[model samples]
Target: MSTEKKTKINGINFRTDIVCYNKIGKPILLIECKSQNIKINIKTFDQLINYQSSLNANYMVITNGNKTICFNIKNNKINLIKKIPLYREV
Candidate 1:
């Protein structure tokens, strides 16, 4: 991540928890890490969803060390997925 780019998402300035980029420096995975005590809910998912318009990451993930959730974007629509694709699959 750079200080210049990706600093503002959806017009709101905030730092992302974790972002995994590919060789070309395109954001492939956007993750939001939370404490185990924090419930994984719509609000948590929304946080990552809010980044889509700006980041355009292919996958969105939220994990709290105990449980993990993953979603994939296709045709500009978001869908919950059972497994995340490997780098080659992307």
Candidate 2:
């Protein structure tokens, strides 16, 4: 995991853990990964949502080794996509 200073509508702060992005700059994607040994549940989803909200990212993803859930925020509504959604699709 890598940490980076990010700015959001709320404020600026350091995000301690996040999956690395393919590119560096402008818009970013926040990925939350879970280990196979751990069980995924609503709490984890809530945490991901909070982080996504704080980061103000256009796209967000939560995944275990087997399953993945993606969200796209547009027009102030969150749309859950079947796969990792792109910014253009948002």
Candidate 3:
């Protein structure tokens, strides 16, 4: 993450979290990091989605130590993208 970039998220902000932005400085994606010891669940999923919507980001990602899932937003709908979101795709 860029130290100069402002990363004020609606919910709790994780320092390790990587939130990407567009050329205009609009938020484009949020990548959430999960602990390896804790199992990912629905509550965490909802929280990530809410944060994404609040930020008006085009994509959101949730990741544990071993795996990652990307949610792509389009037409006001969220669809899971099997692969990581590319900055150029936005």
Candidate 4:
């Protein structure tokens, strides 16, 4: 896992909070962290979506320390998931 990983996409640089890679060094998951007071909503999803456009991660996660939401990205679509996958499962 790498925190605050920087990547350039479409001539813009993005700093992602948490990035996990596969054995081949391909990004598998991207996570964004927020304070527990903040609620997870569309704006949070939108932010992750924008980051995904740059990172091309297979999964996206948004959490406010209390609540977490995960999404699976496939074929340019985002689907909500129940929980984050275990490391071994990933």
Candidate number with greatest lDDT:
4
Model 2 quality (TM-score): 0.65
**Steric clashes per prediction:** 0, 0, 0, 0
How much RMSD separates candidate 3 from the native structure? Answer: 3.2
lDDT of 3 by residue, 6-71 (tens): 334555553426677798888788888888876668987876776676678888888887778788
Compare candidates 1 and 4 on lDDT and give the better one: 4
For all the candidates, what are their Cα RMSDs to the real structure? 2.8, 4.3, 3.2, 1.6
Which runs in model 3 stand beyond 4 Å of their true positions?
1-16
Q: Tens digit of lDDT per residue, candidate 2, span 1-90?
A: 245445353464535246434355534567877887766689988777777766566777788888878777888887887887554554
Best by TM-score: 4
In candidate 4 the C-alpha lDDT for residue 87 amounts to 67
- TM-score of each candidate? 0.83, 0.65, 0.78, 0.86
For residue 2, model 4's alpha carbon misses the true position, in angstroms, by 0.7
- lDDT string for model 4 (31-55, tens) is 9998888889889877788888877
Which residue pairs show backbone clashes in model 4? Answer: none
Of candidate 3, the 10-residue stretch with the lowest lDDT total is 1-10
